[model samples]
Target: MNKQDYDIIVMGGGLAGCSSAIQLRSQGQRVLLLEQQRYPVHKLCGEFLSVEVISSFARLGILEAVRKAGAHPITRTYLTTSNGASLESELPGVGLGLSRYQLDLLLFQRAQELGADCLDGTKVNSVSGGLQQGFMVNTSQGNFSSRLVLGCHGKRSTLDLSRPFTGQYNPFVAFKGHYTGIALPGVIELHAFPGGYCGLSQIETGEINLCWIAHEKILNCKNSTLPDPLWQNPVLAARLHSMQCVRKSQHRLSQISFALKGKFDADVCMIGDSAGMITPFCGDGMAMALQSAEMAIPLVTGFLQGNLSERDLKRQYTSIWNREFRTRLQIGRLLHASFINAGIANLGVSLCDTFPALARGFIQATRGRDHGANLATSDI
Candidate 1:
């Protein structure tokens, strides 16, 4: 292949893209990672990584580095409803909290170290062609070709506009910010308001990350201040009152769709949120992103190595994706819908409070199985 060509091209430098590039490069495949923004930037993410990701991080050889970067273990979860009813549950396994700014940089550097071609601040304008003829990728930097392409561009992107499975648009907007002074050690909290919910957890830097997802109409009514609805939940109110925003400006993202998306488009495979997005309060998005990248490796590698046909690759990937995530996404959507309505939200919280075992089961259901745990014991 020429210098500009690669065996694989991964668009977006988020968890899925970076991890895919790193793993593919490690397998002796030439990989190019195109990222639109430079690293060390804030993203509108909850910053809470579920225990499920620990295995993927370990497989990628960045587990220790992530911990070294200040990720703190989270074993408890606190949830509150709009009506002030609340409950706490011990997580099935430990989660880690680390800001996207730090986590993205770490993964990008690791991919580069493994010899993957990384183009930060470069945007992918369009992708054309397919597996039969390879792919012609046009980008801000230059044009390139690859035998395969992975779409890890995340929940909302221009790339998605041209895709076929761009389901009904969701009107949700999300905001995130890091703050100091509000501390909830070893715990991640989800506080439900009238129209949305906020998640609070401590990242590796001991700074609390507050991320919320809500309908645009709900935010528009706030008129440039914290929403009055959040104050209805006393726990959420006290946490917000005590914290001071660390950034000059909070990171905001709009038009986030939680609608299920297609997994494959002929030759191109979609990973992470580009594949599907879970409701935010599930606290499993980051884990899902990493796992999607991990899942892509075998199918992509098999296709590249001529061990699998293109049709088989797509079929297998789609099957695996649905088997692993379809139920979780469905449950997350149902949960999000319930939490958004004040009456249902209160009833749901009250039920959880009344039945702690049910709450634990619900958490486990949303998280899916911890592949990391199985991988740790396997000889593979």
Candidate 2:
């Protein structure tokens, strides 16, 4: 009705939403980007981009921007067991470490420059769908209609709370913060602990971003309301405890209610953590999110142009996400599951140390360089 306010309305101003908005605007489509928070918002993220993400950034013409914005260049990743046995692997292209506060804002500004009508501090309360008119999105500010709606909201939100997907379970919780005292020698680190694992990397700002995910059982043992002492498991407690200036000490916690799955149709494609998410053990989550957009945008564009049927768009989007992410997430989940048993995790560490080639292969696989049908498949 009334020709709609925008062609596309993207909810959530994170990497996925901003990227999608930018891409769509670059192609001469009018996009409306809504973010619940203003620019420079912080999210609990690994802060380390894989080689595939770096490559995608280059393709999107944002690599130089990232460099100029002081994103750190990471050349390798090091993994250590609870016993301190370590394994290292080199990255094909340098990964960049930039926090969501900086990265998402930069992308949002880029989208604005490309003609996206960005609305910050705008909360999307609900969305109603129709086959003919598509979706009517309700927000705190006002209502907007769009030919398509995209959910880029983070891990869990009111949107998901109201939507009610079947058979969802609260799986695990994640904790992350930024610290300054920890010393990292230009390598990203994954240190294994009980229940789950912790990641450490020196972001471009010289701050170490420490993130962890663990089962609810482990988190319940600490007795304190805070996560610091709870996270002080014998495995990684010493290393993380030594760090100082832990600004933004609050953990971005969320239960893994569901695996990474895009439930919406072409008129409403979900992206990033809003779609299902995998375990962060493999360090490929960011890569998957950005690359998924590259696949979804063309189909979305085709649908908007009336060149592709809505059925075709839904089939194509779901097919592409399943192909690209389903298995990798499964593999990551299996790997993370095995870590529950310290013996298995220690053994994995031993294997990695025994064979540097194994470490290299792990790096390649996580970076999306290991070719397979999931990556090579066409958007049928």
- Residue-pair clashes per candidate: 1, 3
Q: Among these predicted structures, which one has the highest lDDT?
A: 1
**Candidate 1 error regions (>4 Å):** 1-4, 164-167, 222-225, 371-380
Write model 2 residue lDDT over 269-379, tens digit each, in one string: 788877777678877777777777788899989998989887898888888888777777777777888765566878887897898787666555544553222211011
Cα error, residue 379 of model 2, in Å, equals 32
RMSD versus native structure for model 2: 4.8
- Model 2: pairs clashing at backbone N, Cα or C within 3 Å: 260-276, 260-277, 261-276
Residue pairs with backbone atoms closer than 3 Å in model 1 (clashes): 70-204
Candidates in order have lDDT scores of 0.85, 0.74
Write down the TM-score of every candidate. 0.94, 0.90
In TM-score terms, which candidate is top? 1
Residue by residue across 6-113, what tens digits does model 1's lDDT show? 889999999989989988988999899999998878888999988788878888989879877868888789989878788888777678889899999999999999
